[model samples]
Target: MNSFDLSIETYLSNIHFGHFATLSIQAIDNLYTFKGLVLIPVLWWMWFQQDECHEWRREMVLATLVSGIVALLVGRLLTHWLPFRVRPVYDTELHLRFASGEIKDAVLTNWSSFPSDHAMLWMAVATGIFLMSRRVGVLALLYTALFICLPRAYLGFHYPTDLLVGAAVGIAITLIMTRDAIRVRYATPVLRWTERHPAPAATLAFILCLQLVTQFDELRKLASGVMKHL
Candidate 1:
């Protein structure tokens, strides 16, 4: 109704209309599936295995995972609790259904459309990974943009602006949490504790806890899928 909403609606309608959207939706979703779930983690593990930052790696990994989860949850809450923007597909007068049956019904999510969750989660993980390695971060961001963010727009699930804002929120959260001063301040007590304790055991326990938390969503999804199949 206001200028911003009007602008967003107009933009969504414009982008959701043709051959481009058809190509982008499928392409982006597939990219998200492959890059987010498979490639990034595999690459992270490979790199992490060879990492020399033994002291810093565990701390950074813990910070990244915790901060990333918080960012994702905040983003989801903001999108869901704020104004409920409709997806382009449901705006019938807009007539933006480009290709029929190309998108999965499960993906045709009925949630509020502003601030896309896929974009938020991808950006969060990308930001977290970026804190570990700049080169890897850049690749992660590119993967998010090309495969996750772009496809959401193409598939009529989100406006370009939604992805942009979601990404900003994700990155902002990561930066706040992983800033050097914050890290030093938070890690000081933990470091002191480790100094008086078995450092390796403490670090291992910390990493295991983080690994479990980080994989929670993926595991839940996998379990749900398995249950449905059964």
Candidate 2:
């Protein structure tokens, strides 16, 4: 970690909100719940809303969702392929303070923290939303920054640089994936397929959304289990 990361971590650690620390921890723990509640509704509205450019909006949303999945895959691959960096919460040298003192049970002890997956996934989704609709997209970005990324730093799960790099990667990949040519070639066809097979498509979309909300935890666990025996 550089001086910037250390200074920021130190500053966050120094501030204590007393009993509010527990509440903050709870908020951090339950953040995934908010994902389905907030993002799913916004996505649903974005997909079905009637407007002059509704078709483009729907296609863009599809591209954005596809990009989100790709960004997450990239994040996971990078985390494993790159050097394993210790999380701030688990770093003994940092001696960071955990006001709630309950973080150990709540966080992943084994995962690397650099280029946070949370930032990559959510920021990509938010950037896509912003590209589709400025007003709602701004709200989504603000929510991701404050409610999603900030809490991870506050809880010492990630350094600021980790979030920054992950978000940059996410935004960049989404921008590329949602380009007119790419969307026309890929997302448009998928959208048309869904239109033709609404029942199965809806079921698969629901499953994918559930995975996004949970950060693919069960899927990862199952993959790990399968890999162990192979």
Candidate 3:
């Protein structure tokens, strides 16, 4: 809890956009809930667009997905290994002014907030898009900042540094994975298999995307329950 993170949270928590507070909060909530679904179309656009480098683009998409999962796993592992950091709302020192309609999640109260998986996962996807198309990638990054990361920060679910580190890790992994040599060596085989086994590939893709959309909430809940029984 450095002064920098505290300052940003303090400033954001204090301001409520008078007449638009409810509407703004609703919009942010919706963005958080549906962010993964929102990215699907953008990724589809990148994949299916008429381009000479069709195969490369397809390979890049697989690499991006792999990077996102890897980055998120790294972030979650760090949360468990590093000294636990509490979210701003849960920090007794902060006394954050809760946003209208933003109730704390009892389930997440004990979770470490040092590095946000949200930023890590989405930034990786955004970086991959940027690798393929600069214009759309820029928009994706901005949307991530404003819609995804900012909402979490304002609502006190994460500190600014958490988002920054997460984004850096995500972007670095994505950049490395999308390199031509790396994609050709790893992603190319996966793409070839998908081409050969279309039905099973589609089924698996649907499951993966479903997990992404829910941020693995169901899987986490099941794991938590199992741990309790043990």
Question: Number of the top candidate by lDDT?
Answer: 2
Off by over 4 Å in 3: 30-33, 100-104
Best by TM-score: 2
Ranking by TM-score: 2, 3, 1
lDDT of 2 at 84: 88
- True-vs-predicted CA distance for residue 9, candidate 2, Å: 0.3
Model 1: how far residue 150 lies from native, Å: 0.7
**For model 1, how does the per-residue alpha-carbon lDDT over 31-70 read when each residue is reduced to its tens digit?**
4344456434633463346457755765665566556667
Off by over 4 Å in 1: 1-32, 39-52, 100-109, 184-230
Candidate 3, residue 192: Cα displacement in angstroms equals 0.8
- Residue 174 of model 1 has an lDDT of 72
**What is each predicted model's overall lDDT from 0 to 1?**
0.64, 0.84, 0.83
TM-score of each: 0.67, 0.93, 0.92
Model 2 lDDT per residue over 169-225, tens place? 999999999989778998888889999999999899888888877878889889888
lDDT pick, better of 1 and 3: 3
Error of 1 at 67 (Å): 2.3
- How much lDDT does candidate 2 score? 0.84
* Candidate 1's TM-score: 0.67
